[model samples]
Target: MRAIVVTEHGGPEVLHPSEVPAPEPGAGQLAVEVAAAGVNYIDTYHRTGRYPTKPPFTPGVEVAGTVVAVGPGVTGFAAGDLVATADAVGGYAERALVNADRAIAVPAGADLRLAAAALLQGMTAHYLTHSTHPVLPGETVLVHAAAGGMGLLLTQLVKLRGGRVIGTVSTPEKERLAREAGADEVLGYDGFAEAVRDLTGGEGVAAVYDGVGRTTFDGSLAALRRRGVLALYGAASGPVDPVDPMRLAGAGGVYLTRPSLAHYTVTREELAERAGDVLRWVASGELKLHIGRTYPLADARTAHEDLEGRRTTGKLLLIP
Candidate 1:
C-alpha cells in the first residue's frame, strides 16, 4: 500500500511517500479501502513531534472509504459499506484499519471525500458548540481563524444555535468567507479584541472559540465577558504558554479550557451523535464544507507545508 511516513520528527520535508504493507482489520476493526484521508493540524503535530509521536508512523487519523473486511466481533457493518471515522489507524494509506464502533455510515450518495473532510473537524465543532459551552440563543462569541476549515464550521454551528459570531481572520478573502459562513462581523487579527469589545458595547462576548493559540490566547481572554468561556482547542499559530490560574480571576472570572476530540467522544454513543449530526447536515446541504484542495497521496508533504504556512482555507484531503 502507498502511504506517507514520518521518517523523522521535524518539518513537512520529513513526510515521505513510501510503499508499505496494507493494514488489515484486527479484532473489532474494519479494513477500509481508503478513498480519502483528512489533512489536519494534528497530523502536522505528529510529523513535528509536538504531539510526541515516534518516527516512521503514518500520519493521518481521519478517513472515509469502503469496507473491504470486517474483523471478529464487529457487527452492523460489512464489506462494501461506505464508512468514515476520526479514529482510522494509519489513514494516510491505500488501506487503513478503523474500529467498527468508531465508524459512521456515510449516507447513500454522500461524497466520500467530504465525509473524510467533515468527520474530525465537524465533530470537533459539534462538541464545542453543543457541549463545551453550549452556545445560548442571542449570545455572541468570537472565533479565531474564522475562514479556516474548523473556523467556518464553528461559525455556522454557532449561528445554527442562534448565536451571533464575531470572527477574526487574517485577510479580506478570509473575512468574506467567514461572513458567508454566518459570522455577523469579521475583523483582522490586529486589535481584534478591541473590535470585539466595541461590537458587544464593551461587555465582551459570551465565549471565544480559539483554535489559533499563542498569538491569540491573551486577546481571547480579553474578548470574553464576565464568567465567559474560552475554549482553546488547537494551536495552529503555536502552543500557548503556561498560565497562572489567578489570571482567570483578574479576567472577570473567565474560564479557560483546553479540549480534545478524544476526550469528547469517549463513548460510541457520543461519537455517533456528533458524527451523525454533522454528516446529516452535510448531506442535506444545511451545513456546507469548502474543500480547499485535494492532493494525491504522494503530495502529503506539500499539504503540510501549505497548512502550516496558513496559505489555504477550508478542508484539505489526500486522495488514495
Candidate 2:
C-alpha cells in the first residue's frame, strides 16, 4: 500500500509519499480500499503540529471506499460493501482501517468521491446550524468563509431551515457563490460585522458560524445579536489567542462555543443521523457539494499547499 507519511510536523513538504505495508482491520474495524480521501483543515493542523499528533503518522481522517476485509466483532458489513467514514485511521493511503461503528454505508449509485467529500464538512455544517445554535425560522446568521466548502453547505442548510444567511467572503466571485448558495447578504471580510449590523438594522444576527479563526473571531462576536451564539469551528488562518470570559459578557451577554465534528458525532447513533442526513440530501439533490479540486494520491503535498494558500474553493479530494 502507498501512503503519505508525516515524518515530522512542518510544511507540506513533510508529507512524504512512500510504499508501506497494507493495514489490517483490528477488532470492530474494516479494511477499506480507499477510493477518495477528503483533504481538510484539520489534516493541515496535524501536519503543522498545531494539533497534537505524533510523527510518522498518516495525515487523513475522512475517506470513502469499498470494504475489502472485516475484523472480528464487526457486523452488518462484508468484503464488498461500499462504506464511508470521517474517522478513518490513516485515510491518506490506498487502504485504510475504519471502525465499523464510524463507517456509514454509501447509498447505492452515490458517487464515492462525493460521499467522501460530504462526510466531514457536511456533518460539521449540519451540526453547526442544526445543533450548535439551531438556526430557527426568521432568524439571521453570519457565516465566515462563505465561499468555502463548509460555508456553502451551512448557507444552504440555514436557508432550508428558513433562516436568513449573512455570508462573508474574500472576493467578488466568492460573494456570488455565497449568494447562489442562498445567503441573503454577502459581504467581504472588511467591515463585515458592520455590514451585518447594518443589514440587520443594528440588531445583528442570531448567530455567527466562524470557520476562519483568529482574524475573524472578534468580528464574529460583534456580528451577533444580544445573547446570540458564536460557534468557532476552525482555525484556517491561525488559532485565536486565549479569550477572556468577560469579553462574551461585554458582547451583549453572547454565548461562545468551540465545537468539532468528533465531539458532535461521539456516538454511533449521532454519527449515523448526521451522516445519513447529509448523504440523503446530496443524493436527493437537496444539498449541493462543490468539489473544487481532485488530486492524485501522490500529489497530497500539492493539495495541502493549495488548501493552505486559499487558492481553491469547496472540498478537495485525493483520489487513491
Candidate 3:
C-alpha cells in the first residue's frame, strides 16, 4: 500500500509518498479503505514541525472510508459499512486503522467525498458555535480567517444562532466567500478592529473567534466589548506569546480561553453528539461545505504546499 510519510519535519517537500505495509485493525479499531482524508491546518502544523509531531509518521487526522475489516469486539459496524473518523492519524494513506469508538456513521445519502471533506472541519465548527462560546441571539461574533475551512462553517453557525458576524479575510475573493457563508461584514487585515467596532456602532462584539493567532490576537481582543469572550482556537500566524493576566484585565475585563477540538470532544458521547449535529446539518442542507482541493494520497506534499501557501480556500481533501 502507498501512503504519505513525513520522515522529517520541515517543509511541504518533506511529505514523501512511499510503499508501506498495509495497516490492519487491532482490537477496537477498524481497517478502513480510505476514500478521502481531510486536510486541516493542524496537519500543516504537524508537518512543518510547528506542533512537534514524532518523527516518521503520517500527518492526516481525519478520514472517511468503507470498513474493509473490523477488529475483535467491534459490533454494529460490519465490513463495507461507510464511516468517518476525526481522531485518528495516518489518514494520508490508501488504508488506515481507525478506533471504532471514535468513528461516526456517515449518512448513506451523503457523498463519501463530501462527508470526508466536511466531517472534521464541520464538527469543529459545530462545537465552537454550539458549545465553546455558544453564540446567542443578537450577539456579535468576530470570526478570524472567515474564508478558511472552519471559519466559513463557523460563520454560518453563528448566524444560525442569530449572531452578527464580523469576519476577516485576506483577499477580495475571500470577502465574497465569507459573506456567502453569512458574515454580516467582511474586512481585510488592515484596521479590521476599527471596522468591526464601526460595524457594531462602537459597542464592540460579544465574542471573537480567532484562529489566526499572533498577528490578530490583539486586534480580536480589542474588537470585543467588556466581559466578552475571546476563543483562541488556532495559531495560523504562529503561536502568541504568553499573555499576562493583567493584560486580560486591562483589555476589557474579558473572559479568554484557548480551545481545541480534541479537548472539547474527548468523550465518546460528546464526540457522537457533536458529530451527529454536523452530519444532520450536512444532510439537511442547512450547512454547506466547500471542498476546495483534492490531492491523491501520493501528492500529499502538493496539498500541504497549497494549504500553507493559503492558495486553497475552505476544506481540502486527500483522496486515496
Greater TM-score among 2 and 3 belongs to: 2
**Backbone-clash count (model 3):** 0
How much is the lDDT of residue 84 in candidate 2? 97
Better of 1 and 3 by TM-score: 1
Report the alpha-carbon TM-score of model 3 versus the true structure.
0.97
- Candidate 2 TM-score over all chains jointly: 0.99
Residue 297 error, candidate 1, Å = 0.7
lDDT of each: 0.93, 0.93, 0.87
Q: How would you encode candidate 3's per-residue C-alpha lDDT over 1-320 as one tens digit per residue?
A: 99989899888889889899998888899999988999888998988888889989988889998989999999878898999988775989999888999999876656888778777888878878888889889998999999999899999899888998989998999999999999998889999999988998898998898988999998988898989889998888889999899988887899889888888788999999988888888878899888887877878888887877778789888888
What RMSD, rounded to one decimal, does every model reach? 0.9, 0.8, 1.2
Off by over 4 Å in 2: none
lDDT of 1 by residue, 133-184 (tens): 9999999999999999999999999999999999999889998899999999
Which 10 successive residues of model 2 have the least lDDT summed? 102-111
